[model samples]
Target chain A: MAFLQPLIFAIVTLTVFFLAFKKYRVIYANINLGKDEKIAGDSGTRFKNMMLLAFGQKKMFRNLTPAILHGFIYVAFLFTQIELIEIFIDGFTGIHRFFWYVLPLGGFYTALISFIEILSVLAFVGTIAFLARRNLLKVPRFHMDEMTGWPKLDGNLILFFELILLVGIFSMNTADMALADGKYGFAISGMLYPLIDGLGDTTLHIIERFGWWIHILMVFGFILYLPASKHLHIMLAFPNAYYGPLDGGANKGEIANMPRITEEIKLMMDPSAPMPEEDPNAEPERFGAKDVTDLSWKSLLDAYSCTECGRCSSACPANQTGKLLSPRKIMMDTRDRLEEKGAGLREHGADHDDGKSLFDYISTEELRACTTCNACVEECPVSINPVNIIMELRRYMILEESNSTEEWNLMFNNVETNGAVWKMPASDRTSWINELEAEAEAEDA
Target chain B: MSELMASGQEKEVEVLFWVGCAGSFDDRARRITKAFVKILHHCGVSFAILGQEEVCTGDPARRSGNEFLFQMQAITNIETLNAYGVKRIVTTCPHCFNTIKNEYPALGGTYEVIHHTTFLQGLINDGRLKLKDGGEFKGKKITYHDSCYLGRANGIYEAPRQLLELLDAELVEMKRCKSRGLCCGAGGAQMFKEEEEGKLRVNQERTKDIVESKASFVAAACPFCMTMMTDGIKEVEKQDEVQVMDLAEMVAKAQDLI
Candidate 1:
């Protein structure tokens, strides 16, 4: 019966993980379509960034204490898969010492098990610290606005899951140690073996079966919940870090020489002949991004992949200086807007036009408020480029609606007329150099 | 056009110091530009002025989402430089330096650009420049403002402070300075557009640190800093006591003692 339970649990867990993996793959494919261009940099730098950001979790180190604690948990979880496999095999056979043949360090198995138990304790403590920091400590700087759509029950669910895992680990080891009369490995469990010694073998077996079911269920639940929560970073972060833009390079690569609006309209008008106009329509067609389709696929990916960590908001100079702009909020808004649109699509079907797109949701003031500084991108743990979104919106505002700042219009005119922002007359540009005779002589020589 | 040097010959063209829009248009800033040029000449660099031939470098337009206009101006400026056969350019403005050196390449205008602080430091390093210690002016604690382009954007923070150090002035630092320096309200063409809604104007917030330092003078290396801080000082009503001066002007005053 014990063996049947674990085998069934394994099949269920694998099925759920496989389903989530498929869904995430589709989301990833849609996002890659939005990449502006291939980033240019030293290949070594890309490798280093991947190793540090993806593997090393470099960005998380911004919060030093939590970073270290989380690092221990991450490393321990990666290495402890051997323990998990052993537990699963033991569950199937109802024989705790079945893996003795595979134990290379026969006498040291107790020590290894003890070390894993200690690491699990450390991970539990670290998770508690993280929970306290987010909830009780209430770091206002990291708080997100409501529109960002953070899961409310996330903290409670994660904490409960950790507690369940700890209990499950301890109960299994304790039952095993009681059966062996402290002869087996698992020092911590050996200490607790006496407590469960008075219980009958049948009761001990029942406890072991219960622990196995709960632990397996928790793992499977976590896998299923991942795609629906900010915890999606567990899977998304690797690719996000790997494909991040190269540093010291153009924030966005070469601007695509998009066909002018006039040409597009002309093409539409004439099916056969090439249409040419000396001066196209008096009104310029929308040039910049006007809607969701206007956003590059990477932008849509950015929306879906946000962990809602608020690291971007923390790094934003504008946010620090008390601006309305929050890079985190921007990512959240994109995600929230998408969710709303998805709901609308489901309700009204694909052809539904409820007037709910980026145009109606994001205001001109909100768009213009962005300074196009890469602070948000620098701070984003998942490597979302909020600046690109703002730029695309600005392009829409400028080219299509001609709704840009009057100052820019005036500056453009000045440059066109007199070759500068100030529109200075073309006569007196060289007066300062006339005063420096040595400089004059250096020029003449 | 005859003022031009022949092609393939090393030209002794006067330093075509671009005063830039902020320097030439703002009154107090013009004083600093005049003083800066005067000091460069005093250091014996033969430089000719490109009076009307110099136009706006289109930095403001480019930054404000008007790249087309920026390109047009850049092209015109490049043509003017070609007409003058000018090879070397120096400016007190970090914006002009960044635009000319970094942005102009995209517009096919390539020229050697130097910020005045770096050029002045070169003069000091070579012993061509000297400053007479003023023995510390009374009621004057000076903190330097790191202009974004000169400091964070281009990494020219130390040269200006080095020049100040040579003047024997007390160099007080703001809470955030150098690589993590705060942006003056002038970058990204914030100078040209209406201030975006925020808790405080970025310039005013930065100027508060200058006030908090109780520094009599806020020394800066860029024309934008000079203009923005001066206006910011007035906005905060600290203009009567606290003053904003370019590093060159401060160096010029110290030079008078020498």
Candidate 2:
């Protein structure tokens, strides 16, 4: 029956990994539903962006107070992985603190555990502060209109999970120290041992076993919950940053040229040009994005990578001026619509339609309210371009549905007729030159 | 005065003044165009306009999601520009500057494009242009409203500011300036259309920053921003105190040329 312990640990770990893998596969497939777009820039630029934005959290420094608090949790979460290796090995070999013997140096394990102990303490404080910011302090960005129910709960849930995980870690370390009687000499737990030392050996052993199990089980639960939570940003931010627009791309206010439209326009403008062959069976290409399938895969990745921080919304001109357009809500709605369509795809075949499009999730008013000022794009910490998604959706509304304001329609008509935004003709484009010459003559006179 | 090239003149010049639709046709923006042209003449830098040959760069059309119309204009303009072997161009409007500099390369129209402020900065840097001592703009309190296309889009926050720095006026900054600058409610072709449902107008919100800055003269680089900021000042009932002046107009005033 001694094998039962390792067997249970093995079964639990395998089940968690399988479940996480299954969810991840579905997410990957859902993201692939979007149209393929070649991300501009070489590997060097992408790698540099990933390292600076995702790993170094460079953008997080824009707001100093939250960045420092977040840094405590982020840095601790990274160092916690070192201690996790020991936990997994101990669980498999039925040897508590297995690295104690496996590691080459004598004091290395003690030093590493002490370091983890110090980090977990900071993580515990950071998690509590985050919870207070959400519930007590009520940070405006965290409690916006879109963040009412699940988003609010999701934010708190992760913080609570971190707190519990830290509690479990401290429980295991302190009890193990009490049992050791100054042998291992972990810094934080050594100080804590006196409080729990009066509890006899048997009780201390049970507490250690209980805490060890709880910590590992909580990690497994976090893994399964990640794909369903906005916490997925923890994994997706890297790839999203890597595939973000380069310097010469959208950042320079360059709207992507529609190649299909370009080809058609070229053909229409010149009769003498050679005509290209068209396939009869091929579906007509869409001018812009109408749904998740019409958007670029990079846009879908942006949806998954959104942390729901609402920095974009906070900085948006439209949102700040009390308009309906919230860039954060755009990413959230895209994710929601994608998930709905993804579920439909799983049930029905490739041609699955729930009779709902992105318009059903995002209203026309919200789409139209965007100024495309790139404030939202610049404010996003993870390089998620809400403007890209907004532009695609707006393109769909205008080109596919011909849904537009009368003013926009008039502007469009003017441009088509006169080769300018206003109703002025091309012949009058250089009229200012004459006005200048007349003004110069008047000045001389 | 430097010689201004006429369309199909067959004469070469140092640069081409791509007078945008607003600069050419719009009454208010024409003053900016004239101011820049005067500065060009003051410095004796030879330049030309395409006259009837130049059309809109289709900045508004593309931003409004009318790609077909935008491309039509883009193609037509590119043909005219490429045919004339136009290599260097300068524009008073940031919209035209951004479109020709960033978006035209893909459609086979590439040229050395410079915004009017950047062009002015170069003139000042080269010592080709100089200002009179303490002219109309001297010692005035001025705040520059950043154009979205010129600032964040093109990473040109400093060029306009650099031009402003040469003025004897005290240059004060608004709360939201540079990369974090608020929109004057005129970007994305919004100048031609009414704003979508909002509690307060976008430019009104931006005006609050200008008002907070307490500057008398609002310096603007883009024609659209100038219009929006002027309207915002009117909305806030500060038109009497706060005046919106373009960089070229300010520089022209300082040089006693306008």
Candidate 3:
């Protein structure tokens, strides 16, 4: 039985790790399928931004209630993971509560456990409130159009998953505190111990073991579930914020990098500038993004990092005004198409063309619906810029596809010939001043 | 000052005041341009117009996703300004202000550009332009609509508000002000495009907010917002009760420059 236990533990741990690692490799490979373009700007500023916005949840605080609840749950889960590591070690060693001696920082261990206990209970309450807000209360923010179907199911399932973990944790603590004379903080769970107190010592030990295995197994399940879920933000938010376009700020019209495009245009315009050696045999350079591979790696990272929180869509002026554009849908659509492309590459190997892209999922009407007001970029707590994606697609539509509205085509013509949106010639620019001068002279007369 | 450029004479000034497309051509916005021009002369500040030398800043081109056209316009204007050794510029349009101030630097056209509201506020601060005590706008209920480029893009909420404060009118605020200020449906090159199909036009919704505010005098800082709000009011049939005036027009009124 002892040997069987170690064997089972090894198989389960190795299998979960292998599955999660395989998915991680696939995600990494798929992200690199995007074209190489550096997310330029000062690294120090980007780091500061990551710390302030992603880690600190600065944008989330705009709505205090959800921010507090979300923050509570985040911190609680982070702290509980420490206990998880301890449990994992216990599983491998065939020992129980090994942390009791391993974490022997004298009375400080009790304090630490006490703190974790309080957090666990708070996290429980927080998750319940969050679930109620989503399912029962139907908070408007969580009820976006793209949020239906799997996205909706994923939300509820994750909360239920977290609740299961919390139950196991509290039950284990309660069983442990009861079985032993008690040292670790069990204030909340200790109250529930009386109901199970009548069980035999063997039964009590079995129950504790049951709780321990359930908690650890659920954690393993969560790890495997991450890459396919919005919960991937748990591991991705930091890197996504760090890798974000440096100047796309929380204030004003701070937008994404067009440095490459800027340089390209400068080279094309400046006659004195040296041009790149033309490769006649190679394919012509694409004007703008058409496929997932045309976008930068950072944008791919952004799609993967999206938490599907709907902050971007909700804050979008176009979306608010009943336009087709929804920033959340943009990110979700990008991710969906990328995943499909990734599957194609996996099945066929070597950057296979699937004859489709983000455009396949996202409509032109939706793309053009964006106002580029940047409210979406500013509102994102994770620093995702749906406007950047929208702009790139728009750039493609205009430069490559020549697919623009009649008004835009006219404006383009005016800009090309008259150097303005209006057909007024360069000479006519001063016509307003001429009118002002005439009025002043008439007044004098 | 404008005639100096119009006369094809070489001129030098600390600031080259740019009257944008709307201010140059639109009848209502022309009033704003004239008011600002009068204030410039009243203050005895050295400023000149680009006159024929001036071209569009290509803001609409850029926003409308025509980068090639935008670059063409930007480079041409840059060449003209550089040839004349133009340094500082002030514009009455926030779209022009934003494109020139933010986008131009990347295109190698760098200049110290100031919005007219900020310029007017500076002049008031410098005691160059004086306002009448208990001016024509005195004790009136006035609310300001923030143009997106001016408020959110450039963070110039204070300058426009301070321009209004120079009047004796009571400054009222809408529920959505400052960073949360809504767009007036004319931004992002939507000025030239047909309105998207929706339950309500963006201007109508914005007008609803203004109507709910109950301020008779609606002060605006951008020509786009002025037009949109005017149309908004006309749609709601509040043309008799509500009057939309530019910040420059309001200031010029207070100073009796016109």
Candidate 4:
């Protein structure tokens, strides 16, 4: 019990430290947040979306086999917390019988533990399948691109984590088999008791302690390491899924109602109004996002929350058709750039070099290659809208930097002149509808 | 079509069929539209033609990121419909139906929009329209391309296929058909705009799949798709082997054969 108390304290303390570090580095940061304020407001629809996406795992289930395997593992991991707690208690008190008498349905407990044992094995098997599907199978459709930076290492790390979890679970079960004499709480562990009987008591105790420590340390390490890795989905997925737009709705068409162009001119000339360039300390006019600080807090959270699962890239029509744009890469670029900037600020004590911005780092060629398709958002398990981010960047490029594709400029001109993308005269706009009875009213009275 | 009028009020008018931009503009589509109108009339269903007065439904505008223009066109079309007292609209173009039904409501345009396939199916079920036994021309396997607006946006997959079945054509489906149908590089105004920097064209990819299916004929609900797929077929040098026809055209051709 005394030795187990130190383990408990270490786990709790580590959890607090992990949470604090995440809050400080990600949640408190203003630069990475999206510019949109409406995202913060609570809506019933958003809550429903969250429930469907997180608990229901609606998006994940799009791929049937993987979804089922992941579902089992997820549910088992959740319920197995009870077994972990019991292990910790038993290890500390040296009384394996503590929970044995409390459970009214002793048989049910045994059944549940046995079920968990089966589920754990299934989870291990699923992990291997996932690894092969991602790495060994080399499914061209699932292959990561150059922009998917460090995917091989990330994939291996996840496999390692899952392997460690499986090893610890089996070792714990073996230890439990050694400690119990006659009846056991779990069927699988009970079945293994005969095998443990041959091993001496001292050796059994050492193995039990070793398994306990290994399991605890691994769990703690996972918790602390989550915020830094692609596995950050463990913490951010629920919120990201919940906050996603409802019903996979299209983007709102209306622009923000700013001061009218007509009013701006009037105000500039009025004697009562402050003249242009008169006040030296006047706030700089911000047409679009100029830097990371220009983004909203939710956008920042989005950056940190990205799971890097490559689902977005896999589903992207543009990527599938051999376009330069990969939605996964877009998210990665933002996150990596932000982290780089954050590190720079930390190292240089706010005297950071302004030679390059995130835009500078992410090539314009890559940005222009995007078709503005919503496939990424549709397929994303966490519901991150990469299309919106790309559009925002486009807005910045056009309004602030005066950088835009010639096609966009021409299209915009055509739209401005003819009120149509085809650049036909406004008079001919109703030409196609001219023959229908509706045409009479469409024409001038 | 006669039964359709019988099911309605004593007035003989059954439906107001809307011939959209591509239907009127393209020669092949125009023939299909004329055939569809003639078939409907033959069924004893009285219908009114809007003629040249029927302008664009603003699908191209809305999809091309010109929302303002879409709204303007929507308002004009709605006012036109109100003036004509149009309660129901049957359209050959799925894009027109989607815009008039789904998008128009936001712009205060309200009218019951029905795709031609649905209207034709309803007429057939009600015994107004009869399928003429064509005895299968060319004995060619036919695959139906589900338009995005019709299939995914509005859930009108079965009706078109059902119409095809009535024609006695063997409906061969692609591996990714119906709800997961590949876009023919036409929707969202990709038809008018230059193709983005993708290695392969969307239409080419979709057409390649169609070619691989080895179906001699590809039928679609949207004229935009018909145009794109035909172009794709031509590009792949399968122009002589494969033909692109609208569902209405296929139905009309089958009716003529009978």
Q: Which candidate leads the pack in lDDT?
A: 2
TM per candidate: 0.80, 0.97, 0.93, 0.77
Number of backbone-clashing residue pairs for each candidate, in the order shown: 34, 0, 0, 29
lDDT of 2 by residue, A287-394 (tens): 788888899998999999999999999999999888899999999999999999999989999987889988888998888888778888887888898888888887
Better of 1 and 3 by TM-score: 3
Docking quality category of candidate 4 according to DockQ thresholds: incorrect
Model 2 C-alpha lDDT per residue in residues B212-237, reported as the tens digit of each score = 99999999999989888888899879
lDDT of 1 by residue, B164-206 (tens): 7777777888876775466676776667777777788777778
As a whole number from 0 to 100, the lDDT of residue B182 in candidate 1 is 66
Off by over 4 Å in 2: A248-250, B8-11, B132-139
| Docking category of candidate 3 | medium
Clash pairs (backbone) in predicted model 3: none
TM-score of chain B of each: 0.90, 0.96, 0.96, 0.91
The RMSD of every model to the true structure, in order and in angstroms, is 6.0, 1.8, 2.7, 7.1
Task: Supply the TM-score of chain A against the true chain A for every candidate structure.
Answer: 0.78, 0.97, 0.93, 0.83
Worst 10 residues of 4 chain B by lDDT: B1-10
Regions of candidate 4 where Cα sits further than 4 Å from its true position: A1-21, A24-32, A35-52, A87-98, A101-105, A146-148, A190-197, A234-236, A240-306, A334-378, A381-385, A388-445, B1-113, B122-128, B133-140
lDDT of each: 0.68, 0.86, 0.80, 0.66
For residue B8, model 2's alpha carbon misses the true position, in angstroms, by 6.6
